[model samples]
Target: MLDLERRLRGSKQRLLFIALASVCILIVLLNIGVLSDAPGIKSTIIKVPLRGDRPYDTIPFPTSDGSDFEGSYQPEDAHPIAGLMKEADEKWRKYEESRSKTFRETVAKYREKHGRHPPPGFKEWYKFARERNVHNIDDFEQIMDDLRPFWAIDPKVIRKMAAKLQENPDDGIAGIHIRDNKVVNLTNPSWRSETLAGLISRFVKYLPDMDIAVNRLDQSRVVVPFEDLQELLATEQGSRKMKSDARDGFTKNMGHFLNFEEPTGDWDNETNPEWFPYPGRQYMDIAKLACPPESPARNENLTVEDADALYKHQLGGLVTNFNLSTDLCTVGPAIQDQHGFLYSASSMIASKRLVPVFSECKVNVNNDILFPANMYILKDPRYVYDKTYDYEWEDKADTLIWRGVTSGGVQVEDNWQRMHRQRLVMLTNSTLMSDQEVKILTESFEEKGKYENFSHFEPSVFAKKHFDVGFTDAWGCIPGDCPFYKDIWTFKEAVTLSEQFKDKFLVDVDGHSFSGRWRAFLFSKSLGIKATIFREWHDSRLFAWRHFIPLDNRYDDLYSIMTYLIGTGFKTNPADNYANNNNVYVRKHDFEGKMIAMQGRNWAQRVLRDEDIEIYMLRLLLEYGRIIDDNRDEIGYSGDGSELDDFDKKHPMPESPPHLNWNTI
Candidate 1:
């Protein structure tokens, strides 16, 4: 009996040992899997701030003329817009879940094929894929979701928002509210889910007159608790920083602001608002709450008058927010204030009280007349002083210089507007200018080899057209009378004309669109002889003789203008003016011309600075905010905060200065 009991006890001990071993092995395996999946969690979370500082403090709202609000305002009860964002959030969540599944599968496949585990995190996958020349490892479009957060205001919704308002219906202005950057509540320990209505309600408390606010709240929300997104955000941030640095370096070295590096960030892939890229970049570049530079930061508040005055400077227009206009008849009209002027960079409703810049077109979407309203006017990367050339009036080369491809339109027999370029190209010898060598840099070219059908004509076809009859058809002057290339030299190179700053005469002509190079030419310290009919953002501010020497749309006066400059009639004193009835306008001599060049440089330096732009943007926001508030009843916005509804009603837009009449030109 004793022997049998001892054997039974030994069997029980063996079974217990086996069970303990199995449990221990299971725990180890689970831990290994978790560690592999979330190797980047800590790094990613640490970079994100839980709460950010509030953008602005409560201040008295101002009217269009930059005065305190005297009109009565009744604050609306809090009606949360969080429900509006439900669909967006749900779609994002589903995508996150599906993305994780596919990502895991990809990682598994990589490991199985290599006979070893790949890098522990998906962020590393980018580098791995690049090393292997694999582009299809991940669905890039899925990563950058197209369904944005802000819903467009439809007629029904507009009525709802308008009905919510209590005061000022008939004369109120209606504009879109786009929260380019999502505001966050950093004080909360964890990201608290909030709605669009909730966010706007909180924002309007600081500026009550605001009619509507639109934006995607995802950036302000908590990140999904998944390894894949955490990895993507981290990777994207790193990649963006690297690319931004590279672009900054290029711009700085070249002494010009242009985004040469193609945007590789996920945001660039999304179909954003018309004014997304420009203001989005501006907001990100300067993350601080924009206000007047001289105002006290915390101790004192900026009065509406004070803020308005700062933007009243010549460059103040640059300070305004993106104007949102929906039609063409209401574009490019200016509203002056104590500080400067206000114009919509985007779409705004047609109102008699406001001015328009570019009238919107519903039928012909590609109307060459419409300015690329979405493009930011400030220098690309960031505004900076260009002291690269010291071209004194006497020392500058006598030749007139211009270089660019025919992008405005194809110079075919039917397209007369495009003929202007063909006329210029005829001057350049045919043997030197080949098919593939010089042609329009279209949307396809801008995308490099990724997209197609961006140009007006193929390179070979374009060359043939220009060489055959397009040039002759466009140039109205006879062979010898044409004066194709005397002192003027036009060529094509993969570079900006800033390289030719040493030339005495810089010819500024209208391209397929607005002349982006005009700003650069203004700073080149050389005499800019221009012939552009395209009205741009700063058209009202430009004085005929002061900013540049004007030439009529046709080149009829081209030879005569050149003769006045290079001939013995060229005088040094601004007082001694040279005249030619054949020329559209009288030319200023060397001394006065130098002063004008200096003035142009000074204006460019003052108005086009980084801080100048920021001030203009903030002031514009305040102005638009007031416009929304004053007309809320008409536009269907409701909700309350009368304490925040301060306005300036005394001084409206100041008496306008004599602006260059575009119609007459």
Candidate 2:
């Protein structure tokens, strides 16, 4: 009987050992993301050794909770954002393959694209592209998108319009004059004109003497009506008639680029002056005129209350197609009140008239030519990442950070809360000083396995642990409206750019225009979570989800995106040692987040270098030269491969400025 008892005791000890081993393995798997995290993944069975036949036995385990709230957020396994990395990788691969590697290949591709011989100075531009290692030579389609429309109008008429717009401070347009292989004049005394002249002076030697008008306001200038744009596009298409003898190289233009001639007329810069200072009047009174009759901006009418609901439905819980979401024509006209750029943009000098005007950025509703913003070109210290604070992904705090002013628009009493910057601060600051509960996706309580559930978290505590977001000040609101913003919200002291570099993820939302600090954020090692409706010059070079994370302008997806990256912090769960214990396991995505961060950081260095900008400008100038030339049809580049060898000997590039100081400009 004693021997029998000993045998039973020994068997019990073995079973206990097995049980302890299984628990340890489970913890390891859960922490490593092997057990959960991805959508449609994470197993529900544990293998145990069997006494008979098979070496192991499969023990059934509970899956995620099948509750309503659990299904709403990012669940364990099979989430939409899980596949974004692979998608971005494949897209980048395809984009690289699409671009021409050799100069001859670029020339060959251009003929197929434009159906004509290369433009004048095309050979010199190619050499510059090769020397500078420009990532994008073939994709200057934005220049085409803006310049193509002007092809429908008489070149002389376009030139006249350009002259009238230039040197007009009331029009908020700056004139840049390039002559004798140098920049000679920059009309308008704004710093923008000076900085632009400095940017153009880098390669003015390769460019034909030309007049360029740049819009100085944060708002876009041209808003071509939909019917007019369609007709213009058709005419532009006809202008690119393919030449049978079109081949390699370029031909010098017999006709010279003419000086901008002012048209004889009284110019009215402020035709609609009374509309000023009214929030959302730009979209209602002006921008929607660009949308087609069938488009939602023109067709669908919704009150402010209905707009949010409809916008969310139209935009899914997460953003998959960043480009498609920014289509102003697709969304309801209610965006007029929702977006600051649409509502209270600095557009006192906005025009429905089509002109060859350049801007830093514009929405799909505007037709302004896009150029690289000087804010990026200048690289101010305030916007630059502090190298002293930069850390590796594993070493960095797993938090998302954002800091900015309330400068989206001039906020009034009624509409201050609707501005994107204000809304972002409020949402991120939820529950911090109050009992407000915000929904967060974290491991479930009472669940046997690791599964994310849409759980409620105390705002102050939760946001403090995961997010460092707030405004430095409330700057753009009207006098009466401004004081309350300070009262209701806690204004945190502004943190430097380098301070944000310590975090794993950084949020970048639009200001009055594209964020001046975008280039700096991209330069950092952290994930750049960008949310904007405005389109910039380098949109074609980078892929969303791969290089950076894209958020909807509505900001509904902000929390979900954050959860997918750093994870919801520890919460009370049944799996803990005891009930109500705050020891729930949450998934951290360092590997995934770092993968995207490195991809963006590396690609930014590759394609968005200062040299790359100069290369893009040179190519664009060559195209612009062709567009404005009187002998546009006859002017072409016909250089063979031999010219590339003797490029410098044939046409020497001008020496760049020794130093460019932004503060002085």
Using TM-score as the measure, which candidate wins? 2
lDDT of each: 0.31, 0.66
Q: Give residue 132's lDDT in candidate 1 (0 to 100).
A: 32
Off by over 4 Å in 2: 1-76, 242-285, 301-316, 332-334, 432-460, 569-586, 638-665
- Looking at model 1, report the run of 10 residues with the lowest lDDT sum: 335-344
Report the error of model 2 at residue 450, Å. Answer: 11
My TM-score estimates for the predictions, one after another, are 0.33, 0.77
- For every model shown, the clashing-pair count is 50, 20
lDDT per residue for candidate 1 within 1-665, as digits (tens), equals 99999999999999999999999898666666655756543221111213321101121222112223233222111111111122222332343344322334544444343222222123233233323323234223211221110111122332233222111222121223223223322111111112322333332322222223221111110112123333433543342211111110000111111112432122121211112121111111111112222332211354433433332211111111111111111111111110000110111122111011111111111111121122233234222225465455555665567665443332222332224454445433343343323211111223321212112222232223222211212123223233543333333344235556666667765444345567667766776766543444344333444545555333433433443344212234422222211111222224334433554554455444333323322222332332223221132111111221221122121222111111111
Output the worst ten-in-a-row residue range by lDDT, candidate 2: 62-71
Give the Cα RMSD of candidate 2: 11.5
Cand. 1 TM to true fold: 0.33
